[model samples]
Target: MTAATTAAPVGHDTAPTGHDLAEVGRSPATLRTFLHGLPGVDQVGADQRAAMLATRSIKTTAKAWAIDLAIRMVDLTTLEGADTPGKVRALGAKARRPDPTDAGCPPVAAVCVYPAMVPVAAEALAGSGVHLASVATAFPAGQAPLDVKLADTRAAVAAGADEIDMVISRGAFLAGRYHEVYDEIVAVKQTCGDAHLKVILETGELASYDNVRRASWLAMLAGADFIKTSTGKVPVAATLPVTLIMLEAVRDFHAVTGRRIGVKPAGGIRTTKDAIRYLVLVNETAGDGWLTPDLFRFGASSLLNDLLMQRAKLATGAYSGPDYVTLD
Candidate 1:
């Protein structure tokens, strides 16, 4: 059965939902055929690819903002927390002291931390207005049982995470058990109570364009407040091609239900050019409705310093030290 439509999660709660993306029951080939038709994918000729690369010519300020907008969807794990903590903490701290005179100091949308480190991020970003997010539901691999994933989500929300980022069962998804994937996402969403649910698709492993589209729709139908790509665990996380498919899914869902869905293209997205391509995909494919950071996000682990350096260069014609954009 398809999930009945429901309300979105609270503004800043980190709870996960329990509903799954109901099976559309469409065949894989059908889904692929549907996906291949999206203009962003079909229209990308060599010229367009070259144009995307040429986007490097954009003002560094533009590059900086695009990178900044994306790094906000970062997914930090408890295991990786120790090594990456310095940068995250510094960024959180630096976020607290924005230079009002500098137009480039806009804050990241959120600082994604492990549930255990929510307090660390909360304290670091204290009063700076940036959100705190956590990845639950057997993050990275998501190879755990359903109950385990739900418990992880609830725990993260309790630990002070304002948003929850969870991965779908790509294992099940690939096995053709679409309902299982849907149910898992739904369960996490229900558990989130008030937190936003950003569903990760791990597009790299989905293997086919059709699988990506089918999985994307199933997730949104199952109750994903946001459809995200990659967990940053795999070599290939958020690529323009994968993101393009997800964006089309969001657009189609909106057309069908008059409900606007959110998209987060995450993982492995490093350079300023990567950020702009994702943004352009959202703008040109999903249309302007998804442009704001509210409707779209890009997950990244190393995008911040690049953004800061580029921003600094734009402002002073030279790069600055990592300390210049200190994490909290």
Candidate 2:
């Protein structure tokens, strides 16, 4: 794994390095000029590279470490209308101890739930090392007004959520209203207070890889700690190619600004093999600095179960059967 050259950590307090970058989002024209000035993504090359990386194999001790790392980097999520307090609590317990049978198993990075469920998750995860993340800004579809979105963010933070996963205004972004999107993210970040802000781009609706790259840069410039791929509600959620582009964006952004932001590929990522592939992507594209949960995460619920099942198999040298882990 290549070491990261930048020193600025995610959420670092220092100002951005360059004067132009520091003045990036001051106006719509500047934001547009900066975003459009970004180097375009080579869609075909990106796809080929991701596919090639997916084929790189990790085995034995390396595979074991990858599984454990993937487990720790997971944002165990339960974002549904039917989510109950009991369900949220149960999920929190799972996040705290993914493998109840093995005390050596590490806890997941965080527990993500809706705003209404934030209090429940907070109560369940109290004093636990795992973080509590809540999805605000009208969640799956960011159609709500700015004031409502700010209120939603404030409510979640007040309810004890340490992390806020907000969705950018796809409508405004698609319409070329880059400043509006940037301002909204800024407002949401302010309302988040000390809570880390994760800006979800909903890349499936982005229509193209260039737009995905633009949205990623916009989120970071607007003070997003992490630029997420999807909400997992859309039919076409996180993809390796899309995530690769995001990784590149963070990598370049860090090279310029000295601020290392995080990247998360939520949804459609299940099984240990899939998780390992993403790990490889991070190591190759953004270097090993992002291997930790602080700079990388998998926003998934079912993905944890698969990691556990694979982990058990590695420890015992036998498949733990279909009933080895609970179904999320």
Best by lDDT: 2
TM-score of 2: 0.95
Question: Across residues 88-134, which tens digit of lDDT does each residue of candidate 2 receive?
Answer: 98998999999999999999999999999999999999998899999
What lDDT, from 0 to 1, does candidate 2 have? 0.90
Model 2: CA > 4 A from native: 1-17
Q: What would the per-residue lDDT of candidate 1 be over residues 61-102, giving only the tens digit for each residue?
A: 555555555554333222374546565576566444343346
Off by over 4 Å in 1: 1-57, 60-88, 95-104, 321-328
Candidate 1 backbone overlaps, count = 34
Report per-prediction Cα RMSD to one decimal.
Answer: 8.7, 4.1
Report lDDT (Cα) of residue 293, candidate 1: 67
lDDT of the candidates, in the order given: 0.67, 0.90
TM-score of each: 0.77, 0.95
